[model samples]
Each structure stands twice: as C-alpha cells, then as structure tokens.
Target: MRGLHIVGGNQLTGTVTAHGAKNAVLPILAATVLCKHSTIVNCPDLSDVAVSCHILQHLGYRVQRQQSTLTIAREEEGCRDVPPEWMRAMRSSILFLGGMLARCGRITLCPPGGCALGGRPIDLHLSALRQMGAVITEEGDTLRCTAPGGLHGAAVQLPYPSVGATENLLIAAAGTPAETKIIGAAAEPEIIDLIAYLQSCGAFIEYQPGGNLLVQGRRELPGCLHRVLPDRIEAATYLAAAAITGGKITVHANPAHLAAPLAVLRRMGCSITAEENAISLAAPERLQGAGSVVTLPYPGFPTDLQAIFMALATAAEGYTTFTETVFPRRWAHVEELRRMGADITVAGSHAVVRGAPLSGAALTCTDLRAGAAVALAALAAEGESTVTAISHIERGYADFVPTLRTLGAEITLTEV
Candidate 1:
C-alpha cells in the first residue's frame, strides 16, 4: 500500500486550477454509449474514469484516450453482460444499466461496489426502471433486467433527490419513444452538465423551475463534443485545505457552483474574493467556528464536503455541529481525527466538533472524502503525520499530492 507522509505547520500559498467534475464525467462517459461517436474533453485521469472506460471497452466501444481527452465510438456490437469483477470495483458502473438497456433489450451485471458510506440501495433506480416498463430479477449478487417490448416514457418521482438515480433515469428516458417527466430530480450542477451534453447529442432535455426534468426521446442521437464543468468538490477541498493551514490560495473554478461552501467559509472568518472563474481565500490566523451545517440536496451544503469541513472545525475557535442527512455512517473518520487530538463526538449521523489544537499521529483513511479530511488535519497539526489508504483519494482527486505541493504543503507519497 501507499501512504502520505506530511510535515505540518506549513501555510499553503499559490494558485491551482480545478479538474473536471468526477460526478459529471462518469455518467457522461456512460451516456456516450447512446451515440455513434462522442468526444469528452477535459476529463480527469482518475481510477474511476479508467474503470468506466474499461467497462465501455468490454462492451465493444472503440475507446481512445490522449492526455485528458477521450473519444468513444460504437463500432461493434456491445456486450450484454458486464463482468462481475468490473462491476464490483466501481459504484458508478451501475449507471450503464440505463444506456445499455436502452440500446440492447437486456443487461446482466453484478451489484456495483464502492466506498462503505452506509446503505446506498439501488432500489430507487430499479423501481424507476420498472416503472418505465422494465422487468428486473435479482439472482444472488447479480441483477438481470430485460425490456423485451422496449422502453416507453413514464412519469417517475423520486422520494429524495438522489444524483445517481436521476442520472440513470435521464439517460434511460432520453432513448425512450416518448416524453418522460421526472419530479424531484436532482438539480445539481453536474446533472445540468449531463443534460447539456445530452442536448448536444440531439436529445431534448429541459429543466423546469420546480425541480422537474423533461426528456423528449429522439429516434437517434448523433456524436458530439463536450467539455466538462470544473469540479466544485475538488475546489472546496483545496479551499478547506488552505483555511486549515491559515494560508491564502486562489482556485480556478466556477464560483457560482460553490456558493454554499464559500458562504460557510466566509462566515468562518475567511476573506473571500470572488470572480467569474476564480476565487481567492485568505484565511485568518485563527478561524472562528460557524453555526450548525445540514447537508441537503443541490443549492444546499453538500454532504461530500462535510468531512473536510469537520476537520477545519477542529481547529476553529468554538464548537461546530455537522448533521449529515444524506448518507448514514459518514462519520467513519471521526475516530481517526480523535487519534490526532481532535475533540469530536458522534451520535448517529450528527457530529459535534470542539475546536482544539491537534498533534500529528498515524492515521488510516476509511474512505475517499475521509482521506481528504485526515490529510487536511495532518497539514494543520503540530508534528509529522502518516496517512495510509491514499488510493481512495486518488479515485477522485486528479494529481492530488502534486497540487498540494504547488500550494506549499510538505507532503510526499511512499510505498510500504
């Protein structure tokens, strides 16, 4: 395994540009199967991206990558069953269900796997598909689905704004025979980006004012080129890293997509300067703790950044409470942070953090975002620290260690 050895007490400075959004690119890559030819530019080189490309290749797509650009062409007949091993490596692999089913009348694949962020059931996606005239059967770890009569348009409403579920339905509905309306759809910027890409491919998609999405199915979609939006989660992570170390950093990203997190940091006494495509944050010598934060759907605080914010709150002046309503058992990093002298108490999905100076200690990352949280804590601690399971961080962040190094962080990767 590989680990990060970090020397604390360094103020991060300089500027960095955000990479393409992982959440956006994964589904967009899957949607490429809907067209005869497609090109995705500004794609991040992430493990999850590689896995998605491999899945596409297995399905007989002519996939080619040059640097950050990916060109996919459907040249041969795609496979109907995805290998069990490939599906088990990535949760996003489940997204292929909608596009594959739309193209081929049937698909068989095992349950997808990813980070252990609690119970993330795919029941919503399955139910929505069944509502759209799909027959699904579960056999042990595999799921076999068939739409013998082909799929048709239907009205589907989500109990919650699940991003993955919304993307799956949107891709499926785009290839349907008629108009499909989705209620309570996830209105995240990534979802909007996917819709824009689908529209470029001749699919008619509209976002109404009240969290409704309308997808007008077309007889065929043509190949198109698209550039992904900048990753807001990555931008937020770097911003929080700068704040925890009491540094100044300018991030090149879309400021409009990061309104909620940036507002929270500004309330925590960070001097924030906003521009059209860039944001600069100058952290105070000591940060002040903000009030409680509740992770909600789009336009609200994201659950993805909750862990990193918790790490920042550990060193603030007062107590900060974080309530995660999106995912259960997201506090897997609380114990690890406590090992480094952080005062944290977890009760179910809620955690109360008491600001206290932290000292460096050995830590193990439990998941992707939790890895980032520990790295932030180590950067702000008083001594040297070692963090293992860095592979999780690499799954999302592109050039993570190198980017932090550019910001003046004394961090290095070592294999053990």
Candidate 2:
C-alpha cells in the first residue's frame, strides 16, 4: 500500500497544466479496436490507462506508450475473450464489450470493478448493445456476448445520461453500418471527446434534438490520430486545492468545460478569471460556504467534485448543503472527514456541513473522488496527516502529489 504524507497550512500557488481526461481516454482506448490504427496524444499516464493497454494487448492489439502518447495497431492472432481478472480491475473495462463485439463479433468478460459510488450498474450498456442486435448471456459471474450476424444500428434510449453507457453505445454504433440514434445520452465533455475521435475516423456522429446523438457508422473506419481534451475534473480538484488552502493557482484547461464547477467556486468566494484555454483562481483568506449545491448531469454541478467541495466546505464560513442527485450513497467520505474534525451530518443523499477549520488526522480514501477529498482536507488541516490507499488517487489524477507539490503543497508519497 502507498500513502500520501502531507503537511498542511501552506497556501498553494503557481500553475499546473491539466492532463487529458481519464474518463475520455478510457473509452477512446476501447474505441481503438474499431480503427485500423490509432494514435492518441495527451493521454494521461494512469494505472487505469495501463490496465486498458493491457486489455488491448490481451485482445491482440499492438500497444505502445510514449509518455502521454499512445500508438495502437491491430493483430489478428490473439485473445478474444478478455480475462475476467483484468475486466474486474476497472469499471471502464465494461466498455470493451461493445468494441470487441463490433470488431471481433464476440466478447466474454465478467463484471468490472471500480470505486463504489452507490449503484453503478452496466444494465444500460447491455440494454443498448442488445438493442443493436447483440446476444448477451449470463454464465455464473461472467457475461458472454456474441453477435454472429454482426451488430446493426438501432435506436437506444438510456434511462439516464450514463456516461459509460453513452460511450459504449457510441463505440458500438461507430463501427456498425447504419444509423443509430441515442436519446437521453450524456453530453459530458468526455463524451464529446470520444465523439470527436469517432468523427475523425469517418464516424458520422453529431448532437441532435434534445441533446441526443446520431451515429451514422461505416463498416470500415480508417482510424485516426486525435488529441484528448484537458481534464476538467482534475482542474476542479486543483482549484479546490487552492480554495481549501486559501491560496491562488492557475490551471491550464479549457474554461468552457468547467462552467459548472467554476460557478460553484465563485459562489464560494473564490475569485475566478477564465480565459479561452486557462483559468486562474485566487482564493480568499477564508472561504465562504456556498448555499445549496446539487449534483446534476452536464451543465450542472458534477457528482465527481462533490466530495472535494465538501472538503472545501469544511474550511469555509457558515453552513453548506450538498444534495447528491447522481450518487445516493456517496456519503462514505463524511465519516472520514469527521475523523479530521469536520462537523457533518448525512441523511440519505442530503448532507449538511457546518464550516470549521480541520486538524490533521489519519484518513482513509474510500474512492477516487473521496481520496481527493481527504487529501484536500489534509491540505487545510493544522498538522501533518497520512492518507493511505493512494493507489485509488493514482487511478484518476496523474502525478498527483508531485503536481500539487509543484503548486507549493507540502506532500510526498510513501509506499508501505
């Protein structure tokens, strides 16, 4: 196990360039199988990405990584059924089902694993692929999918805007030969990033009525060389880092992708200046707790940043309320925050936090976002702190401790 050893109280300052979106790159990695060759620039060097590359290699794709760049090529002789253990490593592995079914006409894999945030089901993904004429079966703990006659396009209406489902269906539709309409699709920036890569590979994908998507796919995609969008979630984390520590920092990212979180930061009394491709945040000496913050789909407060905001709320003045509409059972961090002296109460999806300065304590990271939350809390705490299970933190943010250290954070990683 590895942990972050942190000394709080120093104000973070300076600029940190954001890495590519982990959410975006995972789906794009899955999408690589549909292309003849793929070159992805600006991909983050994350453990999840390595897992994805290993999955690709398991499926007989030639994979190479040059720092943040990935070059992938296809090979015929290799494994078709992804190992159950590999799929169990990350939730994004579920995405390869559609890509494999499109490219190889079959796939066998078990349920994927990731941070537990309430009910994270892949029914939406299976239902969409089933709508596209793929036959999926349940055998014990594994799922077997086959499209003998090959997949065809069909209308897929998701119950909710599930980002993973949207990406899976998009990957399936991008390689199928016909028109597929996706309603209630997630319009997240990561989804847009995947769509852009698909479009570059001759996949006809565009936003239509009601924020839905249309995919007019072709049998053969020549493949593409695409660069991923900067990670807005990572940007939000850094901005929240500065906010919690009463500091000033600038993140090189696309401001348009961060309107939702930027609005909330400004509400918290952080001075935000956004340019076309970068955002500068100057936090006040003391943060003021913002009123009701709700997590909604895109163009609203993000569920991923809820924990970080809760940590920031701990150092703010007055009371703050967080209603997590996206993930009902994400309050695991509340208990961990309480360990650090945060006054918090949670009843179902609603959490009301009273602002108070935190003192360092041994913290446990429950999930990726939750890990970021506790780290942020430690950054604002009075004394030194140890946050274990930094592997969860590495699953999302790249060079997390080192990056924050460059921004003036007194943090280091200790493997144990």
What lDDT would each prediction earn against the true structure? 0.92, 0.91
Q: Write the per-residue lDDT of candidate 2 for residues 1-416, one digit (tens) a residue.
A: 99989999999999989999999999999998898799999999999999999998887889998988999998764447989878988889999988788877888889999888988888989989999999999999989999989999888889999999999999999999889999999999999999999999999998898979999988878898999999999999999999889899999999998898888889889999999999999998788888899999998899999999999998899889999999899887899999989999899889999998799999888999999999999999999999998888899999998888998999988876
Candidate 1 stretches greater than 4 Å from native: none
| Candidate 1 to truth, TM | 0.99
lDDT of 1 by residue, 303-377 (tens): 999999999999899989999999967888899999999999889988899999999999998989999999999
Q: How well does model 2 score by local distance difference test?
A: 0.91
The worst-scoring run of ten residues by lDDT in candidate 2 lies at 76-85
For model 1, give the 10-residue run with minimal summed lDDT: 73-82
